[model samples]
Target: MSEKQEHASAYWKENLKYLIILLTIWFVVSFGCGILFREALNEIRLGGFKLGFWFAQQGSIYVFVILIFVYVRLMNKLDKKYGFDE
Candidate 1:
């Protein structure tokens, strides 16, 4: 492949890597904590609420929002690194 094509391919690969990692985290927190490990997590408390219940109702959404910011920051850096930033 040409230099430009190689660069673009590398950028896409890195982007997909980030996406997979972040989505995996999302899935683990949303599903694993919320369902699979809920009973175990419920043994703890968060702000007077059951940890698992909190995760089920609020924590995952909070995590998703935080992940959005994290993704934006990561992409901005990636874009700058790839000369795709303004």
Candidate 2:
């Protein structure tokens, strides 16, 4: 393959690893800690809000929003690095 193709492929491979890790963390924090293990987490409270309830109702949503921005920023950097951004 050409050098450009090699660079692009490498870039994608690296980025995919980051994406997978970020998604996994997202899933665990949102689903596992929030919905599934909520009762267990209820033993802990922060500022009048239960940990699980906060995660379920607000924390997860906030994290998701942040994740979107993080993805956008990362993809922008990736695009620029790969010469895909104009």
Candidate 3:
């Protein structure tokens, strides 16, 4: 491949890697904590609510928002590394 094509490919690969990682985190927090590990997590309390319940109702959304910021930060760094930043 040409030099530019190689860089483009690498950038895309890195982006996909971050996407997969973030999605995995989302799934774990939303589904694992909310359903699979609910019983265990319920033993803990968060603001008078069970941890699992909180995760199901609110934590997942919070995590998603946090993930958005995380993704933006990561992409900024990635863009700089790849000379794609404005």
Q: Candidate 3, residues 1-86: lDDT per residue as tens digits?
A: 89999999999999999999999999999999999999999999999999999999999999999999999999999999999999
Per-residue C-alpha lDDT of model 2 across residues 1-86, encoded as one tens digit per residue: 99989998989897898799889889998998899999999999978999999999888888988988998899899889888898
Q: How does each model score on lDDT?
A: 0.96, 0.90, 0.98
TM-score of 2: 0.79
- Compared to the true structure, candidate 1 yields what TM-score? 0.96
RMSD (Cα, Å) for all candidates, in order, is 0.7, 1.9, 0.5
Judged by TM-score relative to the true structure, which candidate is superior, 2 or 3?
A: 3
For every model shown, what is its TM-score relative to the native structure?
Answer: 0.96, 0.79, 0.97
Which is the leading candidate under lDDT? 3
lDDT of 3: 0.98
Give the clash count for each candidate.
0, 0, 0
lDDT (Cα, tens digit) per residue for candidate 1, span 2-81: 99999999999999999999999999999999999999999999999999999999999999999999999999999999
Clashing pairs in 1: none
